[model samples]
Target: MRPVPAKAVTTSARKLADALRSGAQVVVLEVGREAGEGPEPRNSYLAGHLPGARFVSFEEDLVGPRTGSSGNSPLPRASGLQDRLRRWGVDDDSTVVVHTRQNPAVATRAWWTLRWAGVEDVRYLHGGLSGWRRIGGALDTDVPPPGAGSATVRPGSLPLLTAEEAGRLAASGHLIDARAAQAYRGDPDRTGTGHIPGAHSIPGADNFTGGELRDAAALTALYAAHLDGDEVGAYCGGGVSATTTVLALASLGVEAALYPGSWSAWITDPTRPIATGARPCGRTAAERPSAG
Candidate 1:
């Protein structure tokens, strides 16, 4: 099958079914819950999955560690990713669809992680597994072990920024912080309040409500209002939350980028400039003002 352009996230259940009907080898990844939790599929998944869905735990399999060094999600290295993809039977041409438990945030982290490892035909299930269940799709709690097939990544598929690249792009207004208004304003004491020196606030939460994406018209308006379709980058505290915005834009058929390192990386360097109190670059808060 000729590889199509990237898939959108809205109405993703139907889109996933269409992809499956196309007879393309699809790998459905379900981001699992935190530890000590049972191997239960999310409400979305239990109601119904898109068939042949596999499970990957977010905390255990996805995030590596919280060491202050390295990218926030600190990708588990391309070689490890390559091995995982191969085990999952993902070749160069596999169309991997990711679905999480209602929140697009966790799924986006995995999406960005695969992109970092050179997986191009990647997408997230809009509204996540919950959305699928809402639409009366199918589900599978038992995930099969990975199949036997290894895949190699092309060069630059993982075009991620080191702290320096992040700082440079940030200083140039190319990197946008996609956390909530309050977090960007330093209302949350997770870290520094302000954004990266020249970074703009474009919170990821604006993507949806009740596990469904905002309407296309609303998405277009949102993107135009915040991004203006410029060279954009999305990042949250640790790079997980920010992917929600990326997923949102992709679902709207808009091309947005991800910083991956996000605010965590910015604060790593004590010398890096930080901004707080309100939206930088003349943009107003998408929500309540952050308490700087």
Candidate 2:
């Protein structure tokens, strides 16, 4: 019997194909946001996706309903997510692979969410649909029958941070603001203006090149300054893009927490400090004042 993959955070399309051929118990999820207006669910998955791949809505399944105080992308309810996971055929021993068309952030969001939900063997499909096509993997329009999975969702398998904790981490540890540089610098024209005071500006896009994650050495150098921080966390406009940073750090064997509420939630409370301009608060991670 072929051994099932274990502890891998990302899988290439070729490797995934081999695993499937070997009869590994794997569930492939094609996650993305709805497109176009109107009642019909228009998404790339509707056109075509990996054979046996299930569609997971980025807007619906991955996030909870927004409230006045909640961020734009609040974490979904665990029980609700559990039901959806089972419907998607995830089981206790299933090796779940998530992917999207081109946007790596969307796919990584699913990866992070599944990990947070305690799906033990979740992985991001590197290069997404394009990679699959490059490897001559077939796409199927037929939706497979709903799965019968006994997987239980226990949230917080991965580290998470609240607004307060994110703020504190920025001051003492390494808190990364993963929005674009303009947004991080509080461009007047951008939404969610400014960043959490003390957060470092490290756009999530930098982690990828040509729609794929950069090599580990590049990632290491990109994040070299903060790699040794006592603690590390990441946040973005609504908590969507920051997952890419978390994913990149994870690839380098670093466990950086996600600030799910992120900037959207931070700005809701006027009392929370917001910093603007190019400079981030404090210096390098080693220079940060110890939490006493």
Which predicted model would earn the best TM-score?
Answer: 2
TM-score for each prediction? 0.78, 0.90
Runs off by more than 4 Å, candidate 2: 1-6, 34-43, 188-192, 282-292
The sequence of per-residue lDDT tens digits that candidate 1 reaches over residues 71-169 is 567666556667777877787777888877756777877887776677777777777766776667766556466776556865355345566666576
Pairs in steric clash, model 1 = 44-129, 44-130, 48-138, 48-139, 49-138, 49-139, 186-193, 194-275, 194-276
Find the candidate with the highest lDDT and give its number. 2
Tens digit of per-residue lDDT, candidate 2, span 1-292: 1112235688899999998889888899988774552354435676788988998888889999899878999999999999999999999878999988767898899999999998988888878888899999998899888888999999998889988899899888899999999888775333347777788899999998766788899999999999774799999998989999988888877888999988888888877766666888522233333555
Instruction: Give the Å shift of residue 55 in candidate 2.
Output: 0.5
TM-score of 2: 0.90
